[model samples]
Each structure stands twice: as structure tokens, then as C-alpha cells.
Target: MHRHTRRTVITTLLASSFALSGAVALAPSAGAAVPTASCTVTPNASGTSVTIKGEGFTAPRNLNDGESTVPLSVDANGNFQVTRFQKNVDYTVLAVKEDQNFTFVNCKVVKAGDTSGNATGNNAKDAKRGAGDGYRAGRSAAQKSCDVKATPNKNQQHSDAYWKAWQTGADAAFNRYC
Candidate 1:
């Protein structure tokens, strides 16, 4: 009787362990991949404000508001992740960057893949731009281009389209990172 009781107890334990393992195996993974942005912030002595710097900052443009400068989104590598998310039910996150001279703002609006942990859509041209002084120089160049584009009667239709596209991508970046 003792042997039989021991056998029954062992069997029950094994069954319970197997059940638990199966449940765990069937459980859902962390479905969404966390979107990461590369940014370097230099804090002041009091830590109240920071000098935020990154690449892929572009000017915003619209029919009424033409060529206003704003910070574009970046990926894990600090390159501008230029992708648009268009779903009314999606999430929105605010990514604000400010300095003595300018402020870069992005309100990231999420899309299906943006939250799925498997989405891959970043502008290759904007990626791999460098950090630190190189970043500043590149940013200056980009701002210069924007400034040039913003000039009165100097507009190209394709240039306008590009700026508009950059402005649209801010929604996804702000949602994912900010």
C-alpha cells in the first residue's frame, strides 16, 4: 500500500509539472518590440534642462505652414526612422528635444507593425549619420538644406513632398520612443 501510494503521488506531481510547462510554452510572448531611439542629452549643472542633440532633424511643411523646422524620428541607431503610421486607434507618444537655439518635437503615432516588435522601416540614407561633433555638423547641413528649401520661390515639388513625408513620420517616432 505504501509503495502504491508513493507511485500515485509521483504520478500526480509529474502530471502537474507537465501541465504547468505546457501552459508556459503556450503563453504569449512580449508581443511588441520596444522601439528604441538613439539620443545624447547633455544636462546642465542643476539637471533642469538638457542640450538634446541627434541627427535627422528636418523641417516641417504644410499647405498653410511652409517649411517649419522640427526634429524627425530616429531608430535605435539615432538615424531618422522615416515611416508613417495611420490608424486612428493607435497610440501617440511625445518626444520633445530642446536646446538654446531650437526645439525638436515629435508625436509618435503607432501603427500595426510599430507595436508588433517585428517592424523594420527606417530610411537608410538617414541611418548611420554619426554622433557628437559629426552629428552637429550633419545637422547643420540638413538645417541648411531646409533653410534653402524654405526660401521664397525656390521650391521644388519633389522637395516639398520629401519634407512633408518627414513631417508625417514624426508621428510614429514620437509614439514609439517619446
Candidate 2:
């Protein structure tokens, strides 16, 4: 009876060890491929803001524009968007995931009223252009705490659309930043 009990104990120990080894073998390796992300940049007709749409990024991502980083959450479909990004300058937009994996794309904001097309679209384009210009001016004004001298762009100062958008932008910026 003693011999039988000892053999049973040894067999149980060997079986447990084998099971543990198998589990380790089935685990994911450290070298597994990291997820990738891709994005498309669409600058509004008015060059003031850009909409960045991305796919294949993991949850809890960040959009970095060199000067600042904005945290973003990927939706269930693994997609995200950064709407109304205010920087007008051209730069590389970096999308970084929580795991330190990242991807990037260059974005170019078109100058206001620079679109190439027929003459009839010029009016609408001009309005958008004016809005873009106004937004930039307003942001500048707000940055100066709305106390800066009015250095209006001679070309855009005449347009009603420009003034309207400029006021809107200034108000928005002042509310947010100042």
C-alpha cells in the first residue's frame, strides 16, 4: 500500500508539471506584431481647422502636433477623429497608442481662397477664405488678451463674412483661453 501511494503521488506531480509547460507554450510571445494606424487629413475650405480621421489604432491614443498632445479614445470600430484642430501650419501629425506604438502623416493646410475651380464657386470659396483668415486673426487677438491693436488684413477687412467669423473666433478663443 505504501509503494502504491508513493507511485500515485509522483505521477500526479509529473502530470501537473506537464500541464503547466503546455500552458506556457501556448501563451503569446513577446515578439508579436504591434498594431498599426493610418490616417487621412482634410483641411476645411477655410484653412483654419483640419479634420483628422484615423483607423486601426488601439484605444487610448494621442494626437501630437509637436507643440501639444491631445488624448483621444478610439471607438468600437477602431477609428477616431480630431475635428477642428486649430493649427494652420503644415506639420507631421503623430498618432501614438498606449503601448508606445505610433504612426504619422504630413498635413498641409491650403491657403484661403486658393482652390482651383470655376468662377461661380469663387463667392463661396471667398467666404470660407474670409472665415479662415478671421479665425486666425481672432486667435491672435485672444492670445494678446483682446487688448492688441487692430491690425486688420487690408484685403479681408471689407468682407462682412470676414468680420462675422472674426468676431466668432475671437469670442470662442476668449472663452476657452482667456
Candidate 3:
């Protein structure tokens, strides 16, 4: 067979195999579909920013986990982030699965800001990661590891004062820098 003819035959076979497999139907020549936000959170630093540090994020979030209040953007990736939260705060994450609204709560100390309502279903691992060891608990009176409130945890109970102190510290750190 002619060399050029062999080359053409090889190319045709490769293309046919790809078409049949359909694993990579979208090639370099093809356009990649832009992924939209799925699961997210809003920091709400009120309006300041430095750099948000959460996974599966994009513009308009201004996350800067360092801020007091920032909006978070949730994606299908189920990504979570953490800041030095000293005090106890309330938090919640909303996820939409198949157009059904679902809320996950009772974990974060302060409220986790609502996503722009643009979040779709979240990845289980990422969503669990964002929850953060179950809220800041509180700064140990010794200013050590986090402290937990006397309130009942998913597994146990703690003192309210402990939680209060932790919450106070958290509020100060978050509100001040943010």
C-alpha cells in the first residue's frame, strides 16, 4: 500500500474508534462546556476583601475566608473552606438536588451565609469538608484548641460559657479583620 494511503487509513481508524467509544467526543478542536456554580457560600465581609480560600469557587464571591462576612459560591464539587474562627457562630448550607431544596445545618457555630441560590447538588466529600470539625466550638480559656458549648453536640454536650467565650473570640477576630 502507498505510505500516504496507509496514513489516511490509520487516521480514519483512529477517528472511527474515538467516535465509537464516545469517551472523548469533545476534543481540543471542540469547545469545552463552561461549568456553572453548584454549591457555594457568601462571606459577607459586609464588602471588603483580600482573597477567598474555598474550593470550587469563582468571581463575585470575594471569599477571602479571612473576612468577617463574605458570600460563598457552592458548586457540584462539594468543596469546603475554613478560617480562624475563634468564637461560636451559626452556619448553614443549602443544596438543590434535582430542583428539590435541601438545607444542612446545626454544625457551624455562626450562620454560614447562604449561597447566591445558584448552588446545585454538592459533592459529599466537599460538602462535609466545608462543615469544619463541627463549628469553631470555642477558644479554650487557655487560648488553645477550640472550645465547645455546653450545648449538645451530635454526640455529646458542653457548657454554654465555653461556647460563649469561643463565640466572643470568633466574633472579634472575624469582624475585626474582615
Candidate 4:
């Protein structure tokens, strides 16, 4: 009985030590930092141009402006800047980092210098509504065998937001139907 008790205590101590070591091994190291990314867009030239600044991104960064993707250069501190980025419509800018990690920010380029703080939301709503309307119109044009084009008419009296949205909708409709 004495021998068995001694053996049991020894086994328990060994098992406990092994479990503690395993947990320590599995713990994350203090230097194992998580990757991060961010971006900001500044409208320029009445929304015709934009300056995008980004930080916390690794090398091989790229900027995706909903319409095109352009490679970017990063400084030693993992920051990037894109100046004079041409843009006509409001854009959802994406900052892509290594290994497909990315972050996105919406830029309201159409309403330049509008500091109302509601421009982004309002523009999004307008774009949504315009897309819907354009889609419907495109469907109708397809049914009527009319040319479905997204080109804005100079004579049409519509808000820039609305017209841009309409063009997008019409173009999408044309692709799907015509």
C-alpha cells in the first residue's frame, strides 16, 4: 500500500508538469502581432481626383477602386499614399494587403467639400435607388428592343448622383438583357 501511494503521487506530478509545459507551448508569443490595414480618401479637384493614404499594411499593397485595381508602393513603415487618383463617382476603396487581407472605406467623391456628415449615407442611398431604377429601365429597353446604353444625356436634368447611378444600372441591364 505504501509503494502504491508513492507511485501514484509521482505519476500525478509528472502528468501535471507535462500538461503545464504543453499549455505554455501552445500560448501565443508576445511578438506574434496580428496584421492590420486601413485607408483614407481625400477628394480633390471637385471629386475629379483623390488622395488615398493608408497604414498598417504589409508590402505588395494594391488599391481597388471598384472599377480597377492598381499596385501601390509602401514605405518602410508600411504606409502608402496614392495622389491624384482620378475618380468621377463615389467609390468603395479597398486596401489590399498580403495574403488577401484587406480593409475598405467608402469615398463620396461626387459631393466634394460637403461636410454635412450625411453625404456618404445619402450617396449610398441614391446609388442604390438609381441602380434599381436603371435596372428596371434596362429591362424595359430590352423588352422593347431599344438600345440599352449607360451614356448620360446632356439634356437630362438629374442630379450627378442620380445620373451616375442610372448609368451604372443601365449598363448592368444592358449586359444582362442586351
- Please report the candidate that would top lDDT against the real structure: 4
On lDDT, the stronger of 2 and 4 is 4
Please list all clashing residue pairs in model 1, or write none if there are none: 33-117, 108-171, 108-174, 108-175, 109-171
Candidate 4 segments whose C-alpha is farther than 4 A from its true place: 1-35, 88-178
**What's the best-to-worst order under TM-score?**
4, 2, 1, 3
Candidate 2 residue-wise lDDT, 18-72, digit = tens: 9999999987654332343455456666667766665555566666676777777
**TM-score of predicted structure 1:** 0.20
- Residue pairs clashing, model 2: none
Following a full C-alpha superposition, what root-mean-square deviation does model 2 have from the true structure? 19.9
- Candidate 3 per-residue lDDT, tens place, 1-178, comes to 6999999999999999978778655443222222222322333454332112233333223232233445555445434554433232343333333342232222222223433232223333323332222233222222442242322143322222222333444443333333
Evaluate all candidate structures by whole-model CA lDDT and list the values in order: 0.34, 0.55, 0.36, 0.60
Q: For residues 15-43, what per-residue lDDT tens digits would candidate 4 score against the true structure?
A: 99999999999887643424434455667
Backbone Cα, N, C clashes tallied per candidate: 5, 0, 45, 0
Pitting candidate 2 against candidate 3, the one with the higher TM-score is 2
Segments in model 2 whose C-alpha atoms lie over 4 Å from true places: 1-35, 90-100, 103-178
What would the per-residue lDDT of candidate 1 be over residues 1-178, giving only the tens digit for each residue? Answer: 9999999999999999999999989765543223332222333344344333333332221110122333344445433333322222222222353321123233332232231111223333322221122334334445555332111222322222223233334322333332
Model 2, C-alpha of 18: deviation from truth (Å): 17
lDDT of 3: 0.36
Candidates ranked, most accurate by lDDT first: 4, 2, 3, 1
TM-score against native, each model = 0.20, 0.35, 0.20, 0.36
- Identify the runs in model 1 with alpha carbons over 4 angstroms from their true place: 31-178
